[model samples]
Target: MHVLVLGAAAGGGFPQWNCNCPNCHRARRGSVHHWPRTQSSIALSADGKRWLLCNASPDIRAQLHANPALWPSELRGSGIHGVLLVDAQIDHVTGLLSLREGCPLDVWCTPNVHSDLTSGFPLFPMLDHWGGLRWQPIELSDERTVTEFAIPFLTDISLTAFALHSNAPPYSPRRGTPSCGDNLGLFIVNRQTGQSLCYAPGLGQPTPLAMRFLAAADVVMVDGTLWTDDEMQTLGVGSATGQQMGHLALDGPNGMMALLDPLPKRTRRIVTHINNTNPILDDQSQAASALKAARIDIAYDGMQLTL
Candidate 1:
């Protein structure tokens, strides 16, 4: 199994165009310690012949250019087989528009997300003119497994969705209630080696069910959207807490750091979907030191893991 980190920064990417926070300021000046990053996205491939994108970031074009493995092999032929969306967030699903190049593509998501894309955003009908969109639903079971879904173009790998706490995207009218299929963390297992990976770039809290799924994985990549609950408000970036925006902070008494501390040491714990305002973006910051001490890795673009 090969998992490639196409982009690790959260929504707007590091050094967003309009903002100039301290971290973003340093990154724009090309500081050695603060490198720029794209929005959150990953590519999963078992044999390197075919790739499945976890989420289509707005930076998809740049990300695809940076990674040659996803390039076209023949005339109008692409190595990318399908896309699996974890949520309907704009940053996560906006890149689908870039993919509409008269080539058929398969998209997998939960029923709720599918509805939002079709009715709320109306992105589905718009993409139909280019090529075709084959929407596949990834259903969850009472056993805590997303069953009956596999990469149609790849073998020896199975996909599952673990429920997480998340709200509907801000644009959706049906934003009042959250459901099991509203948002999800993905589990991709290599049936041949029993090596598995769990990805949760949008997290709320460490529920028992979420913990159990994380405990069972060999590699875990989770949300690192904010270093503290009040990071955005403190930096004057936004008024909402990290949780209020559908992300769990990395520090504090009930933050991700403490929740992850109890997991098995053997699991490789990496943090992705980092917000630019987070102090952890600065390697010299105390937050970075603390993260290093806790044996957690901050994911960066182009990082690769093989199992």
Candidate 2:
């Protein structure tokens, strides 16, 4: 399985156009230590000809341009076989609009995420006027049973949706009940190779279920939203800590470091969906040193890993 990192930054991306935070400032100035990134997304290929996109990030156009493998000669109309959405967030699904009109793209997503897209945005209606799109809903259960779905041209891949704790509180509007639903972390395993990849971007912390998935993965690309809980707050970039923003803090107990320490040596761990404020983007930063020492990689745009 060949996996390509399309964009590694979290929502808003590194060096967000309007923000004047120190990290953004340094990125704009072209400082070597601070690497600029786009929104989070990834592409996976079994034969390296046909591709399956993990998420249709807002930066999909640029991401496709950077890696032509995603745009195969077989591309007609919309230009890809299918897209797998991890959640219903704007950053993940908004880029579906960029697909070519009149081309029906197969979009695989959970029921809640599909509902959110079909109702939350008017763009779906507008896009339908051009040409209707097909949605394949994947029903998720708390049990870690492997669900298999076939990608056109490519072989079937086993996907397991693991339940995760939402960052939002029970009273929070974002926290929908069982009838509506919460976000999910996806575990995709290539049937041909038996190699699996785990992705969980918007998570409050690593659940035992998540760890179980990670333990079985050949390549694990977990969220690296913030170095510390108060990283953004201390930097005066945001009022809420990283944990409060729906992601795990990278340090301290129940953090990324502690979770990763016990991971099997064969499991290749890489951090993705990184926030701009996180100093892990800086190679010289102590945070970066710690990650490297533990054999965990900080994902960057255009980075590719073969599992």
TM-score of each: 0.97, 0.90
Off by over 4 Å in 1: 143-148
Q: What lDDT would candidate 2 get against the real structure?
A: 0.76
Residues 180-266, candidate 1: write the lDDT tens digits.
787898877989999988898887877777887899999899999999999989988799988788788999889989888988989
Highest-TM-score candidate: 1
Off by over 4 Å in 2: 72-79, 100-102, 144-146, 167-173, 176-181
CA shift of 12, model 2, Å:
1.2
TM-score of 1: 0.97
lDDT of each: 0.87, 0.76
lDDT of 2 by residue, 176-259 (tens): 343324567778887877888887776666667777888888888888989999988888878987756677888887798788
